[model samples]
Target: MIAASDADKWKKALLEWDVTSLEEHPSSDGVCVCGQTGLLWMYTITNDANGAELFPIGSSCVNHFGRTDLNRRVDVFHKLALVQATANAGKPVEMTTEFFSRAALKFLFEEGAFTPDSYNYGDGVNDYEFLLKMFGKRDKSTITSRQGYKIRKLVTSKIIPFVLADPRVR
Candidate 1:
């Protein structure tokens, strides 16, 4: 298992590499799918006051239907990717739908963050929801099926940008 110190080190490195716009924006406290809680980072993507995305900092793994090692690595890689994606965009990108749903999954599976599961848990929650809980957001109901699908699209859209812009992963 990766030590907390090691994880912290990885987080720090990822922050240095990705988090570009460090200016403080409005944020809220929420739970991740994993059941952890902290200040969730948020960003406004629209000129209108209503268009904003809330991203929980760390999420859980309850929904991950893969091997332990893969799940852990994917979790770690995603933490790094989130910081990088935010930095690259210079604002809070949609964490719930965009970041976690798409890019994070690819990074997790492609990077061998987790191994495929032989059996399905068939739980109502998904890996993303699990991540949300892990980060401390308790309300799994808040994440909807549609939102999950959107997140997948968002991640697929941003893959090229993320890989092209960030040389570390390449």
Candidate 2:
């Protein structure tokens, strides 16, 4: 993280920015504009008025800028990162039930992950219905092996890529 020489200027700039995208780094090498280093999660914030952008900002710095909305967004990305890490390590991500809340799944759906083009479970269950069913299962033990496999596949193939795609800055 590079130290901001003009703290007031940077803070004012941050107030005009809103989080536009989020990304996860495999290693803790991310640097925030605020001079904080070792960030594993990076956020892209864009200033709407001037169309300027700052990326790879630490979540704490974003919160310190009073953007709690980014904090909530971070939680969703953090959960996805866990599944992404597990999948990248060749582990089954399906057995985990604690990572995704209904809202997170809904967010992904809204982002076009579970749409007809992206996912077709082929079991006659629509994406929204599938998500509802998955969320309804209260425990990992209740999630069948098939369900688990589907969950892992969905996270790896659909949700993660779509959510982490680079946002088109205006």
Model 1 CA deviation exceeding 4 Å by range: 1-78, 81-136, 159-161
Considering every candidate listed, which one attains the maximal lDDT? Answer: 2
| Location of the lowest summed lDDT over 10 successive residues in candidate 2 | 1-10
Angstrom error at residue 90, model 1: 28
lDDT tens readout by residue for model 1, 1-170: 11212234543422221211111223546454345655343211111222222233232322232335434444445455565656567754445543454445545445433322322144323443444443344465677787556544434444335543544431
Q: What would the per-residue lDDT of candidate 2 be over residues 26-87, giving only the tens digit for each residue?
A: 68898887789998888787666666678878888777766666667666666666655655
In model 2, which residue pairs have backbone atoms overlapping below 3 Å?
1-35, 2-35
C-alpha lDDT score of every prediction, in listed order: 0.39, 0.64
Worst 10 residues of 1 by lDDT: 15-24
Task: Please report how far candidate 2 places residue 85 from its true position, in Å.
Answer: 3.2
Tell me model 2's lDDT, rounded to 2 decimals. Answer: 0.64
Q: Model 1 Cα displacement at 66 (Å)?
A: 35
Q: Quickly count the clashes in candidate 2.
A: 2
